[model samples]
Target: MPVPADQAHPLTADVAIVGGGIIGLATAWRLTRAGLSAIVIDPSPGSGASLSAAGMIAPVSEMSYQHGRLFALMRDSAAEYPTFVAALEADAQTDVGYRETETLVCAADPADRQMLADLQHYQQAAGGEVEALTSRAARRLEPALSPSLSGAFHSAGDHQVNPRRITAALQTVLPAIIRRTAVELIETESSSGTAVTGVRLDDGRTITAPVTVLATGMTPTRAPLPDDVPLPLRPIRGEVLRTRLPSGLPPLLEHTIRGIVTGRPIYLVPRADGEIVIGATSREDNREGPSVEGVSQLLRDAQRLVPGIGECELTEVTARARPGTHDDAPYLGTVGTAGRGPISGLIVANGFYRHGILLTPLASRLAAQLVLRELDPPTVPESTDHPATADTDHHHLQTMNPRRIAHPAAENQPQGGRP
Candidate 1:
């Protein structure tokens, strides 16, 4: 709900997060858990790219040759998911629909099989536990799979979560949320330099805080920031479909199916509630709405993998944009000036194209630490026993620096980014 305008003119908190998607809400939740007051501002919370995601935490299946840092980040985030969801559910008293099901990567034809083979070799070399499976062996594990599959691989480490459930859970535990658009950032000049005090909402209200976080996924919310603060982000739109199986029919799939059919990649994620999510068509034409051609292509490719999909009811079609960068990696750090180190109270946590859901737990924790200026912590092993140390966080932030426009491997890759 929108905060009533007459109630207050200037809201104050320890941190003001601009954008109420998974990143923003989860960051606020983390801040509150750390004994800090934080408020989230957005026009509609949880209705952006987070809602359109299939929520696959598939670090292995989605691995790319050029994105080694991203792969490590994804792997680490997925490992922390159990602890994150447990804490969130305990606080919210609701399930976030997290599933630990394995994923099956399939190939439609001979050419697709060759491509799958190449990916398997790379996955093995990168320390990903993947097994190349024969078509018969793959069908045995997933009986509903089409017998026409030429090749497949088993990724037992891959899993998924319900993005909507996650956002709802975070919303329940957060302290404050103003349902309004943040139109601009409020800056204050001090002896040190210019620092972000808070944000100016569209309703003529202001939110004042020492720290401000920009987690606005794919929304161009960075327009309010200074021109020198680098945020080279672009929108890559995707279309997804939802369907329900017939009442009498059994579940269509036991595991998530990710496949390539004639060079077009697609995935079908099955839920316990008899719902299957089929997607997605990645494009850059800037069509903000669902396209007929994209829908047709998804259904066709999904049917090629699971023929039973044709019998399901077409429940819904959705289109949303995922924030893309030149290297297809996220921009997660403080806003830096040309000569200055970092702005006093400005942090950026955006450009998470396809891995937003997978990266939520770590991203939120890192953002909260940045807000409290608690970047340094005692050194500890990589486990749930203790939070990540400054060494780990700094390494991640450096890899995702907003000012670094080009990646070392970006120009060498044929796609020029993550495929």
Candidate 2:
């Protein structure tokens, strides 16, 4: 389905996005609605992390994560999500399956119960709201829950949305999305030195724009950046499976059921369709496809959470490497610059890790704001610690600036600075 070079016409826009995943498409849509011309250069849109994500918009669930600033961003994004989704639905004229239901965190055994209690205390200490419930109380809410539960809590702030539907909705509004791979990035001379001008497609068509966003996840069709900087984006392979419930099957999972089996996190998210998404193995490997052992383990862990899933039909198993950074934080600013980049029109918006689906609203908002020069990059602090430990504020882009090198040592740094 590749477009022939002659058939593809050259175009121009105010903002040109390199990748057409949710991050790129959503940003393009936001810019276009803001009265600026926007175009996305990607062949298959929203088929990346957006498609694999189980859209759990729960900042509350991730309070205990190592990345504190990411938690802040998630919480803030979640707070404004209802309004964002409402406006997006009105504009796109399609339901993205934005469910505002509470997420039930349950325990599987007595030891797990203690862990839940400890987590509750930790959340409470962090000034977060969560209602503790006994096993009986938890089952009263989700009766289909495991009968061997020890304890549970209700995070009222947590919710779920269908990521697939959201991706489709984003694609609906960004009609100028180019279904072609970018063969090269068009960088031009500016006072800031080397800023991206536009993109050159594989078919030899050139689409010029003042700004070009490097939303291209993990793999880039061409090198859009300089060789001096390091992106440090690696493929953290994740295997996710979706199962279809049999006809006349009762509602088994009312809300998103997340549990900590031992130390690993397992989740079973219900979709609007009869399919429930039971994923994912967080493997630190460069493997390409789903492994037999990985898929089996996912099924085992999910069945341990809900035994009824054993009867569900396995609909799909997708294995993809999410763009992961050394610090487990995203790089979000002008590449190879010292924060100020009106002249350097290269904006980075990748390395989202596991929060891609949840961070869409905020990420897209930040992307648009960056394109309009309305917001500045947060400053990344000096630290020997991993990127996740960097103390930075999202509002004060000074400390969390993506332009800084994520890992100074650069273990898996891309060669020649161009991928």
Candidate 3:
């Protein structure tokens, strides 16, 4: 059962997060652990793109030739995932679906082999460890691969995690006041039209805090932000399909597979359960609804890569809009102009695109450290507290309890099997 909104406690924290996605939850968890009171406000926590994400932590697999800084950030974040997941599981006492399997990049056509070869050359030049593999040798690693596969490359460091489980675990474990409501930031005061002071919510409630972090995914585009804040964020739509294999379907595709066709890129990821996810068509302009043409094209392309998918049971088809920036790189670090002293008390941590889950651990740590004003412990955030406000409204404020506030919505409710 879902946690009741009426029963949710209301209290001010040292920092307040605007989104409840993986990034926000991870940030809130790290902040609360550092002894600072943190609050996360979102209407639906895990129902966004994070839920529909394929959760591939591929710093090298998704590497590009131009973006060196972005690749460094992703590499740092990927390296932190193991430690992050271990600590989170130990703290939350729940499994977060962490997997350390390597990823394979395959090519089916002779023309596509050059793309893999170019990627191999690029990876080598960028000091990444990638191994060129023949089709026969590739089948040795994953037996279900198509016999007609041309060539492949192996990236041992690439990993994946279940995004839903991570989001659920963060929501369950964090000592944050999770409020299931929409919040809009109303600027109360500014200096030189650059610095922001406080924000007012939609329900006439005002929150005055020393620091506020905007982790509101693509919603920041719609927020009343300053013109100087160059968010440069937009949304990119991706369509994904999920299917289940029969009891004895020979365990097709052990590692994540990517195909570099003449057109866009396509990928397939297999879960621990029988579910195999084939995704992602990138659409530049249209993001209104799921594209039947897109889905059909992906299925056709995926089947061409691996022929055995013809017999799988189609379970679900879903679409999600990733928060993309102008250069496809997330905006991290302090907001405001160089001479403006860090925009007073606001920070922007959005525009992660499809890499939100892959980059959460490091991003959360950086956000928490910025909010807490800590100097040491370079990469991630730890729990800590800040000075509480003098005017504490006990009547209006809910009790200060993390478990009570972050409880799942469906807990303690009668469960009738999915109808």
Candidate 4:
């Protein structure tokens, strides 16, 4: 039995993960599967930035210029997703809404078409599997698309999974979770050095562990850390909307529709149950709720790509902030010194930004390897086809090192801003 939140009893585990978003929960799941006891600490799981995400696993359509390392990590994660979701579903006895449907990148105007042509060229040069398509071919795949589209392209490898279902499955399979907020880190100092021993909850209970993973997203209530550990995380708010087609109607789209309408990007992700997820507008503000302007712009841009979007009923409007980093890449490595020496027992997995859902598999697997000190973890049954490549790329890990922005000597490293 679990101890009550009001009780002052302390718990022990192999790993104590802060934050219960998909990333946190999935990492915990990975650790538990590796024969280590782990616990997730959160006030409410799956109610943060992960809740509002459109869950696009399209590394091709989502690619940008000069983010080669990040793109490689994304592609590896997308490849491993099938194995990840299959094992999770079998273990939890629930579907995670994984779909292999292709993605269509549409251009709604002449300017948008030109921009897409350039992006496609960049994507092709980067070894991405994308094919140019005429507007007629795109409409044949997704008839709901507006006929006024100037051009389109096919990203056959890009796919998606429902974030809500994935989070719920992780919650089900993970054996331990503390339903409380982590207020602070419990550090222990010894002759060796200062190491994080565990975490202190808001209810005054401490969960002791040898390793503590800080997978906290963009929540304002995150625990305070020491001055030396520089996270440099910022919040990038996004607005997303969910809509349902009227009864007796088919899904408005088969493949996900990612489009640039009047130079602004929008996407429509249609679910099997006739629900289409549309979004989003990126803003660098501190607003806590959906804004009128953001919603109006999303609706307008989305309707321009798929004319049928205007007839759907809006079900939910979500506004949440994603944790972004200086280089737009996730901070995956452990916090360390100038020589990349890791601080004992402290591992960070944050600043995933917009790719949180898509990056979960690779992030979770890598975190588990770090915690267990395993160099060659066995691939899950279905993941054999796509071996774990990103975790082994030394250069990629260096670029994603959390200390890059913190260390004075490492400050000269190249920085890539958000696209």
| Off by more than 4 A, model 4 | 1-10, 337-341, 374-386, 389-395, 408-419
Candidate 3 overall lDDT versus native: 0.69
* Model 4 local distance difference test score: 0.82
> TM-scores, in order shown?
0.92, 0.87, 0.83, 0.92
- lDDT by residue for model 1 (71-129), tens: 77888778878989999999999999899989999999999999989988888888889
For residues 1-419, could you state the per-residue lDDT of candidate 4 as single tens digits?
Answer: 32333343448887888999998999888877767878899888899999999899999999987887678888878988998998899989998889998899999998999999999999988889889999999999889888999999999999989999998888888777788889998877777566788898887778888888899988878876666677888889989999998999777789999999988999999887888999888899879899999999999999889999999999999999999998898887666554433456677889999999999988887777666652223322222334765335445556566777767454334221100
Please provide, for model 2 over 161-272, each residue's C-alpha lDDT reduced to its tens digit, 9 standing for 90 to 100.
8888887888777657787888777878756467677888887788888778888886546445665566778888888998878899786777888887665677888876
lDDT of 3 by residue, 1-419 (tens): 22433244454556767778889888888877777766677767876778789899998888877765556667767878888898889987888877887888988788888888987888778767889999999889988778888788999999888898888888876655445453555454465444444455655565555567778786533335565445555678888899877887677768888877664588988888867888898776656567989889888888877777777888888887788876566655445433442354566677788888888876777667656552222223343222222122111011111112123232232211111
Best of the two (1, 2) by lDDT:
1
Error at 89, model 3, angstroms: 0.9
Candidate 4 has what TM-score?
A: 0.92
Give the count of colliding residue pairs in each prediction. Answer: 0, 12, 18, 0
Deviation from native of the Cα of residue 152 in model 4, angstroms:
0.7
Model 3 scores worst on lDDT over the 10 consecutive residues at 394-403
- The segments of candidate 3 whose C-alpha lies over 4 angstroms from its true place after superposition are 1-11, 177-183, 186-198, 220-222, 337-341, 374-419
> Model 3 has how many clashing residue pairs?
18
lDDT for 154 (candidate 4) = 96
